[model samples]
Target: MSGSFGGQSAGGAKKARIEIIPLIDVIFFLLATFVLFTLSLDKIQSVPVDLPQATPAARPITEDDLVVLQISEPGTAYWNRELISSTEIPRRLLDYKATVPAPRVLVSGDDKARYGDAVLALDEVRKAGITVSIETAFRATGR
Candidate 1:
């Protein structure tokens, strides 16, 4: 078979064209991916804490040893083994001479005790030129 070619004198020439649909689709897909990533942000979680319970120790109280100041739930306070008013703590402590050896104060408060009472007791003990430490009872390991 014989064929006739179009154009000027012999072979034909044409300008190449590029398709834009695929390019446009790729751009849209990237934009959608970025938008989704930005929309789904990270989240955090937290929890509240509860104070721990204390166990009673198997020991006895003695005088001229480590002094323990207990502030009971009813707002009553004790110095060593004696029940004394809050105001009398400083005077009694001051009257105690260095020769008698004033003992370290251990302020023990009830679970439902007021924070102010404990802090005030510590302040008074410090003012009386005495050292202080917090007392905690240890749980028994065996029966």
Candidate 2:
């Protein structure tokens, strides 16, 4: 025998209902957390420059002996991090040569930069009799 209150059985229980709004909020919060976490894990160590694409693949260089030479569209030149004039290239290369035999210099020219600017940079390096190479992006093989 069951007791009745207001014409309803007292022993009967109501079905539990899930609040969809709160569940959706919890899911969005988790999604945001993962997105922020993934973005923080990527570390990019590179100078801002637009590299030109080339048919030849880019060669990987790990030797610390290699020096970075950056040439922008406005004819600005930077050796490693120090900005220098075109006239200063030979002097700097010579100074480096005295310490390291057969110094290898990597010239990174902006895609929008004048071709003559790159030539001028290379000319100075050649004048100093140093081996120099250019940095280029390898052509993408697939879509």
Candidate 3:
């Protein structure tokens, strides 16, 4: 039998080999899929609507037209220097908007004031459709 156990020819067994082309193709396919998925994450989903066109106003606004809305430490709201209750904010804003051609508000709060009060004032100002700005002064709190 010449040491052939199965009575077959003496051809050696084929060595195991990794096919590089198919491996590379699979890796490139996964990379392309991952890149496309990541790119899609940045898309914003929103409802499309037709917006109104803005017409430029002939008159320009001045510093005197600026309104200051201040919130104090006790959560009290002051409009330009006058103390006003929270319920009065919306009405006052609407009245001011009606009277001024271009309405703008400056929202400020005391260093220790309740943040909710300031946010409420800002929300009312926004509901009134007026432009608003926040005060950014740094004051040292005497601890």
If scored against the real structure, what TM-score would every candidate get?
0.45, 0.47, 0.53
Q: Which residue pairs of candidate 1 clash? A: none
Which candidate do you rate higher for lDDT, 1 or 3?
3
**How well does candidate 2 score on lDDT at residue 143?**
7
lDDT of 3: 0.79
Best by lDDT: 3
Question: lDDT per prediction?
Answer: 0.67, 0.73, 0.79
- Clashes per candidate (backbone, < 3 Å): 0, 0, 0
Least accurate 10 contiguous residues by lDDT in model 2: 134-143
Candidate 3 per-residue C-alpha lDDT over 1-143 given as tens digits, one digit per residue, 9 for 90 to 100:
35444434456455457889999999999999999999889777999999999888678778768888887655367787787776888998999999988889988876766888888888989999999999878432221
Q: In terms of TM-score, which candidate is stronger, 1 or 2?
A: 2
lDDT of 3 at 4: 43
What stretches of model 2 exceed 4 Å from their correct place?
Answer: 1-62, 138-143
Q: Compute the lDDT for candidate 2.
A: 0.73
Query: Cα-based RMSD of the predictions, in order?
Result: 15.0, 15.3, 8.2
lDDT of 2 by residue, 7-123 (tens): 455767654577899999999999999999999996979899998886652555457668877776464667786767666777888888888754789887755556888788888
What lDDT does candidate 3 reach at residue 56?
Answer: 80
* Deviation of model 2 at 25, angstroms: 75
